[model samples]
Target: MNRKFWSIGLLAAVMLISAGCGQKPGAAPDNTPEQVTPAPGGQTGQGNEDPTSGAGGASTGNEVTKPETKTESIKSYYTDPDVMELVEGTANISYKEDQDKYEAAYQTLQKSDNPDMIPLWEKIEMKSLKFDNGTITIDVHVPDEANLGAGGEAFAIDAIKKTFFQFDEVKSIQLLVDGQQAESLMGHVDLEYPMTR
Candidate 1:
């Protein structure tokens, strides 16, 4: 009988030690990576806890954390025969360089749309962009100038100006056609002078 009691007591002690070893003091068991949830407010969570809440307590609404935003502003143009206005939009150009930024901006303009707005650079090819001091010169190849209908030249020019001028580094823009400084584009806007931001 003494041997039986001793064996039972030893078994109980071992079970207790194993249970205690499974969990640390004041800490929860580690969760598997697959069980972890993402953080609040669209941010990624690091662990199995609510990311918006503090470590010690529930989160206050005011203490909510926000994910870092990666975006750049591009100025888009909309023309109204009665009035002209500036329309601003955001683009994912944070990873782009200066030339890439211009290309991205132009591509955005190409894709951007508004019921009252006319798209610029439609069917126009962007050959290259050159930066010198504060001046930005763009060489373009227009397959057809007749595509720019009535008052389209002004709107196109405005769109180019607003888009490139969004960057402080560009103080002026000089348009080039087929690698030469044409006197005018589509016989509407003069290309002899560089447009200032």
Candidate 2:
């Protein structure tokens, strides 16, 4: 029994020495250590957290607010495959608070769900959109590869106008190519600036 107790005391002294060696110079020799926790990224850290703060870290007031998102019904227009006229298609758009609603609606116009409908806007990329009072100005980038004729050009413009005019706030629309007003969108029909609803 005496040899067993001496052996246990030696083991306990070695453990105490090992634990004390790891502690900081001025740190108090704690009989009962405060619960040490695993920090973020699976890192083990000393339990030196402020009692006033929330469990994980700082207070909830410092937490970043998430951006609100909403899903809305969007009305988009496509060109008829046969007549090349405007065909309305309704879709649901989900967007964050800071995102542009008009851009979402405009993107929906680039795709058609109906088999008979054609997506004319797919030929051109919308660079940007600006609104003034009630007028919507659209800037587009038309690649040289797009071989759109006069009829296609007219129907494309018609689709854009029809799609935007669905909104009550839009009174008129002006089209721009590469941020400049051109005599024609594709050297076809004359572009009527600020086409009114």
Candidate 3:
């Protein structure tokens, strides 16, 4: 999938800035291991690892360039089947220098290193996802095979929100079915468009 992305440094810098905003001015950014920001008000994202592993930046064309990779530390958020709450895990995604980091991060959220957590987006499919000026527009299509019941819908949304919001560069999200706006992704919850952090 072709995706646009802000530099990993930019994403981290945004996260650092936003993380500091919730605290006193000049305060340090929060990296609490077990931090959990409730849903609907998910102002914080799950990432805590320093995004300092970036190497080469975005490239263009089919020009043969140096073989370099960008390794970004990501926060993986999954739903706990037993507790019904989000379980957090740290993951590292390495992609081609010209590849989109957001795509790697999104894929990381699909499953967890911890087996106890359930992948929130295992069955759902995203047609397209784009990020611009702090907003992420996600065009999704859920097939009947997913069977994401009412409760499952809530968990999926929460997990997705928290997973992306962990990046301070993302200020809001606009969810769409196919390519148009909708009240809900699965006719379960009242999905408010342009959901803010």
Candidate 4:
């Protein structure tokens, strides 16, 4: 939509940062296959080339695969590097005592040359951020008369999720508008009031 509207999304991003106090981030993308493919016929491909075994194997449906072991990784709420640049470079933002590392990181991030990020970065209104055990929360505010736009809410959440997921400390995120959950920030996406990462 317009700058004023997108500003809201930027503010939300800042609020997310504020919530987090001093944590690293989250884990990496899930790589362990969540779904397994079954063979054509009733057979196994564990160690043989039996035709009856099909290609891979048969569905025993007896074993239960466990989730991947937890690894030391960072989680982020923001994905767009450009958006992160806005959050990092906005001189309006203030930090808690321990959030300095993230601030520094943002400083470097501001110098990132990813061109795709330019537009999104310019439209946001970054505020303050905090990092706790892992979750990073930023506090933000949009001009009362802004017009965020369709899908603005989703865009905002996706940005945060992508950004914080980069670290390992963050696990979840929450969004607040002027301090409360509301309907779509614009008209396309749902904030779901207090979104989680």
lDDT of each: 0.67, 0.76, 0.72, 0.46
lDDT of 1 by residue, 12-34 (tens): 99999999987774363465543
Better of 2 and 3 by lDDT: 2
Report model 1's TM-score to 2 decimal places: 0.54
**Model 2: runs farther than 4 Å from truth?**
1-67, 97-99
Candidate 1 lDDT trough over 10 residues, lowest sum: 57-66
lDDT of 4 by residue, 1-197 (tens): 69988899999988888766434333323463544434455433243344443334554454445334332222222224333332322222233334665543333322334444333323334466667766666554555344434434455556555555554666765544555454644456766433455
RMSD to native, candidate 4: 31.2
> Where is model 1 more than 4 Å wrong at Cα?
1-70, 79-94, 113-115
Error of 2 at 47 (Å): 20
lDDT of 2 by residue, 39-94 (tens): 78433354335454465554434433455788889777776777557677788887
lDDT of 3 at 158: 80
lDDT score at residue 149, model 4, on the 0-100 scale: 49
Scored by lDDT, model 2 comes in at 0.76
Candidate 4 has an lDDT of: 0.46
- lDDT winner: 2
TM-score of each: 0.54, 0.61, 0.61, 0.39
Error of 2 at 177 (Å): 0.4
